[model samples]
Target chain A: MAFPPEHEIHRRRFGRNIGVAVTLALFIVLVFALTVVKVTRGDPMQAFDHSVRPELAAEEAE
Target chain B: MSDIRAYEQPGEAGFGDYVQLLKPRVMSLVVFTALVGLLVAPVSVHPVIAFASILFIALGAGASGALNMWWDADIDAVMRRTKSRPVPAGKVAAGEALAVGLALSGIAVVMLGLAANWLAAGLLAFTIFFYAVVYSMWLKRSTPQNIVIGGAAGAFPPMIGWACATGGISVESLLMFALIFMWTPPHFWALALFMKDDYSNAGVPMLTVTHGRKATRTHILVYTILLVPVAVGAAFTSIGGPIYLAASIALNGWFLIGAWRIWRRDEAMAEADGYATEKSVFRFSLSYLFLHFGAFLAEAALRPYGMGGW
Candidate 1:
């Protein structure tokens, strides 16, 4: 079947749709990067945050 | 012909309309403060995670903005300053805002947990709730103290950033939070002084509307007096250094002079000058906050060189 001609509503809203699409794509990339970083860094607490709570026994200090 | 007629409707919203619904200007403040909070922390966060956490924090802040617009659509439509907002201006529906707020809120909170930790996530959730429900729904229309309490919601971002890095709060985060909290009243009251009818017309119970212009001026002076110590005192914290101290003392002195000038003016004098003093002070309040946060960022940036902190 042939595609119907574009309507004004669709034309006006085209940018909105694309913006939302871009936002969702970025969200996905961010989440994937977060996952990779979390895995590679092991325990986030041990990797950072030692100075803030120095009283706690050092698990793995740099 | 009927379908064509239907399709010809004007005032249809663009993507920017939805962005306006999120209150991008306010979100920029949230993003900046949160980034400073993260960067200034003694704990180091991975770049990727820091970016994601700040992103979600900003999303959470935007969610609160959407919810505020949703709840305030009536008042927004009435206020000249807010009449052009997407919902009140008929570019978007209230239900759509509510939906966007809820969806983004849930996603942001949960994702913050995954990216950072539960502490940061919980703080984000609380900040959203404080702004959306506590301030927007409850306090905004009820009391003149609305902005004072509502300011806490805005103040939470830095603490959340600190939490994101350290998984806990500290004196430094608390001081940052306090700085914004104390500054909110005077900053907004100055705007209210010049905005005149925007709050009164909307029945928002802003200090100017509830007490009186004279009383509002006094309140501005009082809050500015209170804000000086917080702003200057932060210079003595771990995140503070010579740059922050110099900036804070100068900025706070200028801010104090602005407040005192506003306090000394009467309505007749203000009217004769068209609230010029109020408007200038309001403008300065923006820079006051940006520079204070910038000082925090500077101190953190200079720390590696042994120049940032004492």
Candidate 2:
């Protein structure tokens, strides 16, 4: 059909759907970027990795 | 025949309603405090990770906010300040808020773990639980001391942000947490003091409702006094320096004077003057917090040039 949705509610629903779609797409990008960062990071990044980092030490010493 | 349903209910919810269900105003503070926490830490985080972590942290805060709106819809409908909120105003269904809250809570916690660390994730999870279950569900309606304890839920984001950077909590993080924590009572009590009709009509046991207005004024004074130390003491930490110390002293001094003025006023005087002092203090408290955090940001920014921190 070549016509727009008949009602204002339908138009609103269309907009909401677009919002959800864009949000989902952004989330996917975020996940992918986080994966790349985690994989490419040379040193262990988390505190649980048992590696001693000075910044983490600042938590105690500061 | 195009037989698909256009909408589900008698009332329609725009995307904005769903966004409103997340309490965007509260989320802004969460994002700001969390950002300050992440940046002020002694360690550095990758920009992508930092951005993702802050986003998820804000989402976690928004999720908890949605849960609060869901549970408090009844009182929200009664209180004038909240009567126009999405769930209460019939723009969004309570069940939708519940679903969104629960789903976002899970997603945010898990995503933060992947993007940052398990400790930060765990802290985020606890903050959500604290806000949604402990504070919103349990403390808010039941106790006069609700704001005192419930404030911790709002206070956790900075510490969580710090954890995202350093992978753990620190005195600096704790002080940031404490600054908001102590600030909440007086800030809210000042609001409650002025919006006197809202809580009592809704049967919410706000300090003004349970304990008398005079007592709440006293409480405001006491908490503001206690808050000054925590805000000023942060200056001695790794994240703090001369700038933060100066900002805290001035802010705390003004805040104390406001609280003192609030304490000295009887309801008759307040009513005659339209609670002007209470209202001004309430407005000032927002700036008070923003400036304190801004000072922290300034210190962190200037640190590389041999000027910022102690």
Candidate 3:
């Protein structure tokens, strides 16, 4: 089941290229996705409105 | 002269080999789910601390990967899917992987504790132990239902991340954990169907190997069916919103169709068709989990407008 030398070389080259392309594409997609989420989601503080101190106070006062 | 082998082996290991040891692909999933957990939590952490916590979580995930590689090098050598790993390929020594894994595990847990809370650190420690000791050493070779139970290791990051932010676990975090837990069997089983020979050759007791392929297929369908309700249920949780509901409905429908198709497949037809059905289901399983979690993010985004949860 030995691959031909030339075929092996070609396969190795193809694998290397695919790995690089996939890694780069993943990086680009991650950056794009995070940026979109950040822009659309707004700030976390604004979403919750309550802080650690207030929550603690309310719990203790209860 | 023979003892001076350092002179002959002048170069240190390459970066790619180190990356391979970390199982970067698996770490990506860990990072995504943990990010979702952090984002959807009720408490707010500073941006820098949030980033640091995620980074440490990712590092901890990588450490588990390295340890798994170290421990499974023998079996990995026999399995085509894993034969090219750094340890199996001899690019990285098993001892080096163990050292790296232990070092990273300590750093990630301690740093996460400092940046976040002790609860997150404790969860991270337990996760590393679950993956390295319980899953890898005990269950993987010993049982057919390995992935079903072992999947808990992979399901912990989000809960840990949630704890990092809120300093406690909540039902929301547990729901997130459940989503991944229920999703793991069907997902891994699909791959097992396609790679049955790999497990058989390596003498690993994957479901497809211990049970017949038909039974495995039925299990996949059943798990997929069960997964839909869990996913849809999460949409009604406090962290879930309209966007998540819509996404869950659409994705779960497609996944169910795929799983049903897989269940209907006969072994002869699958073999005749080069297992196209299994391969497609396997690929879809990957996207299914990712998209479901991504929708959770979408739900979080819509939370400010009162468009999410009831």
* Candidate 2 CAPRI level: acceptable
Interface RMSD of each: 1.6, 2.1, 8.3
* Model 3 agreement with the true structure over B170-264: per-residue lDDT tens digits: 88899899989999999999898888599999999988888799999999999999988889998888888777889889989999999999999
Query: Lowest summed lDDT over 10 consecutive residues: which window, candidate 3 chain B?
Result: B3-12
Which stretch of 10 consecutive residues in model 1 chain B shows the poorest summed lDDT? B1-10
Summarize candidate 1's per-residue lDDT along A1-62 as a digit string, tens digits.
99768877787689889998998898788878777777777654443464575634454443
Global lDDT scores for all candidate models? 0.92, 0.93, 0.86
TM-score (chain A only) of candidate 3: 0.52
In model 1, residue pairs whose N, Cα or C atoms come closer than 3 Å (at least 3 residues apart or on different chains), thus clashing, are none
State the DockQ, from 0 to 1, for candidate 1. Answer: 0.51
Candidate 2 lDDT, tens digit per residue, B1-310? 3434534454688788899988899999999999999999999999999999999999999999999999999999999999999999998989999999999999999989988999999999999999999999999989999989999999999999999999998889999999999999999999999898999999989989888999999999999999998999999999899999999999999999999999999999999999999999999999999999999999999989988998
lDDT of 1 by residue, B1-310 (tens): 7767757677788889888988999999999999999999999888998989999999999999999999999999999988999999998999999999999999999999988999999999999999999999999999999999999999999999999999999999999999999999999999999888888888789988879999999999999999999999999989999899999999999999999999999999999999999999999999999999999999899888887888
CAPRI grade of model 1: medium
Comparing 1 and 3 by lDDT, which wins? 1
Models ranked on DockQ: 1, 2, 3
lDDT accuracy of residue B167 in candidate 2 = 98
Over 4 Å off in model 2, which ranges? A1-5, A43-62, B1-10
